[model samples]
Target: NFATLPIVAIIGLTIATMGALTSLPMFWPLPTALLSASVAAGGLALINSIGQMAGFLSPYLVGWIKDQTGSTTLALYALAALTIVGSLVALRVSRSSAVKVAGPA
Candidate 1:
């Protein structure tokens, strides 16, 4: 499955931090790879922007979850669940014809 490694990495995050960190890079090129050459740059830009936004907001979200729950455990679990959902979406995208590379013109 396309999401297999990422799902594994997410689970590893709750265990060995370094192992998860190393595996996380394995999917970094996925967004650009899914785009056709004609739209690669713009697609990558949008993807990067979204990623940056998530990175900026994720800590605040986790902190808020922690405040509401009085423990970081639930926050971490929520983050992990969200990450798994993201991976599944990526897998679906990878399978969809919309992202297939165009034939030579």
Candidate 2:
């Protein structure tokens, strides 16, 4: 239902914020990084909004695929394929070139 939207947003955004806070220290002097806190925050929000577009479009796309195929099987595979591809891409992320500003306790 439509109520799921806000709930997903709430959880997703909290996790995203935690991720940003945890990772910011690794961006010390990168060309795209080294940003002020506010600038980084605004950038994160912008990126999050763009990524959330999938939430709106993916369901509709899956439903249309279901109508065409007469089954949820293909739709489920499509979603699973996306997750797999994302995991593969994530595996390729290079180690951070910038050192952490805060050392572990």
Candidate 3:
């Protein structure tokens, strides 16, 4: 994920910059333009900072799981299978539950 950091940063910056630039025509006053830009930049920074922190923590978690299991491949395969089964079960549960709420809609 560290390798993907630069790409993510660039994407975040582009999104924030474009958002502020696009809002320039709508906001009117110069103060509003500056505030819009500041808001966009702040939001982007918050989101990307959280993502970056998660990226760093994920490796440590994977390492801990691998240490417990002795094999990262096996751990990953086990997790994948469990995830598939969980998703299927969740889908069924959701479908059944939704049936109870499906009234006249």
Candidate 4:
């Protein structure tokens, strides 16, 4: 599932450009796969909310980092680092069988 995140992040870093548009689609199935059909809607909603928040804040954060550092390198690195952290979290989630919800009734 999220096992692909680290690979995508590495690709993004190598490209040195934002790959959100392309990479986002790969993650769309995650919530559905992880949650029961009953709570899948909520899981999707939560993911959407987080995505929207990131979309709204990321530019500002990038700009701030650029202003402070006089370059976008640090910002990109920061994003990559965060991506790695997310990958680790995803790994943990994938290992937690107890978090998997029951199938549709």
Q: Rate the local accuracy (lDDT) of all candidates.
A: 0.75, 0.62, 0.57, 0.74
Residue-level lDDT tens digits of model 3 in 1-105: 213588886887688579756754543332222334546567456646965886587667668888997767665555557546745764565345332223485
- For this target, which candidate reaches the highest lDDT against the unseen true structure? 1
- TM-score of structure candidate 1: 0.68
Best by TM-score: 1
Model 3: how far is 100 from its true place, Å? 34
Which stretches of model 4 miss by more than 4 angstroms? 1-26, 98-105
Clashes of 4: 0
The local lDDT score (0 to 100) that residue 32 gets in candidate 2 is 33
Checking candidate 2 for backbone clashes, the offending pairs are none
The candidates, ranked best first by lDDT, are 1, 4, 2, 3
RMSD of each: 7.7, 9.4, 15.4, 8.2
Q: How many backbone clashes does candidate 3 have?
A: 0
Which lDDT tens digits does candidate 4 get at residues 1-105?
213589886775556545645656656776677787888899899978987998798889889999999988788778779877876776677567435545799
Clashes of 2: 0
Candidate 1 lDDT, 29-103, residue by residue in tens = 776677777888888788789989999999999899878988777887887788779878878876784465558
**TM-score to native of every candidate shown:** 0.68, 0.50, 0.34, 0.65
Residue 45's lDDT within candidate 3 is 67
Across residues 1-105, which tens digit of lDDT does each residue of candidate 2 receive? 213588887887688578756754653333234344556677566656855987788999899998999877788688768856754543443243323346588
Model 1, CA-based lDDT: 0.75
Q: After superposition, how far is residue 79 of candidate 1 from its true place, in Å?
A: 0.6
Higher lDDT: candidate 1 or 4? 1
